[model samples]
Target: MISLNSITRNLDLHAQGNWLPIVVSLVLFLYALFMPKKELSWRDLYITFGIIGYFAWISDSVLGKMLDLVDFGNPKITGIGEFLSYSLIPSSLAVIFLNYLKKTNKWILTILFIIISTLIEWGMRKVGYMKVHGWSFFISIPLYFVVFSFLLPIHRKIIKCRD
Candidate 1:
């Protein structure tokens, strides 16, 4: 059982934390470099990074603000930067899983991922590692469902077209 104070304290401590994301990115970069071209090429990895990063930035930063989903406790521009930074981990992992693992059944993956991600987030929130200002699993679950479901067929089409 986690406490709210602890969670808040942890989040404050890691408010600007970049270590995890940076380390993960480095690992992915290395894997992209050494892995066989057929498994995943450096070019495809870059594209994946670009697409996921951009979408996360737009969805969590730009649209989030427009919809009043979050605020950064600072300037709007800074809020956007913070959102992008915080979003990098999940977004990058998503791309890596999709590209490297080549698992096309994204609907199932999305559900599983969302459930695990949500539980983790909830636990973090309870421990003070995260603060959900305006969102909850009820909101996030459905949103991820729609987003990933839509992406599933698109990813399948892309892979089929490539082969």
Candidate 2:
């Protein structure tokens, strides 16, 4: 006997977790679209966007749902908040990373991106957007490193295929 009102009540739209995902996703999407693209072509942008978005989705699904290492919003249900946080932001991050990567030192920039990503995740956790289970926050440091590190290699492979 689950009512629609009960589901809606659980959303807590006024909470940061409910609204921030949509807002952050929109902002990041706009930024990715309008940001300077001196290092990437339209194809690169599009491909990277899809690849990283899919990667984020897959990784989150495996780690959060399958293995139960974390929870994005409520563990009982998946919603728009989880979608935006899991997909768009990471995709935008890939775009942004590739854009700056060409102009900076690779290892240094990768580390910086990892740190920034970890901090962002910490912020999201603080805002109630996520909950970690069966793992410590420190685990994300290396996880972010792996994700950011892969960005360059993947972009390069795509460009190689195109060229």
Candidate 3:
């Protein structure tokens, strides 16, 4: 019978690194990029994208490097893969989330996005793309919840400033 131990062992043995992060980033970015920007202006999109990317970098640096709560990409070093994954994914997701916020119920969508984000992180860990040292899904869920919950308000603030 295939046990959890066997599966984990196989993963460790086959850890040739995968293209999941880049591919996922590309898909999200493409979808967000090609979609109609009915609710946000070009300036709003640019500002929010930069804000998200900057926030992601700072948060990851503290949590993953300083606090050692997480590890991304290779176990040994930080490189372009880690940087691009951190930068692009969150920025693209923010754009997509903001675009969708217009047509969806904010509360429901926020909760759903949090769940989905947590699952993606969990999958990344399971597939050897990430390692959780001092973190758990519990922490991640709340973090995502707060992040998504704030996104709309932040976007609105940007819009308000633009007017």
Against the true structure, whose TM-score is highest? Answer: 2
Q: Which ten residues in a row have the lowest lDDT in candidate 1?
A: 72-81
The model with the greater TM-score, 1 or 2, is 2
Q: List lDDT for all candidates, in order.
A: 0.53, 0.77, 0.73
Question: Runs in model 3 with CA error above 4 Å?
Answer: 1-17
Best by lDDT: 2
Q: Mark the 10 consecutive residues where model 2 has the least summed lDDT.
A: 7-16
- Span of 10 residues, lowest total lDDT, candidate 3: 9-18
* Best-first order by lDDT: 2, 3, 1
Model 2 C-alpha lDDT per residue in residues 79-161, reported as the tens digit of each score? 77877887788988778878777545778879888877777777778888778888676787877787778756576566748
Report the Cα RMSD per candidate.
8.3, 3.0, 8.1
- Which TM-score value belongs to model 3? 0.82
Candidate 1 off by > 4 Å: 1-39, 71-87, 100-108, 152-163
Candidate 3 differs from the real structure by a C-alpha RMSD in angstroms, to one decimal, of: 8.1
Winner by TM-score between candidate 3 and candidate 1: 3
- Any idea what lDDT model 1 has? 0.53
Across 70-139, the per-residue lDDT of candidate 1 in tens digits comes to 4432323343225434455455555545554445655566777667556644544554433456766788
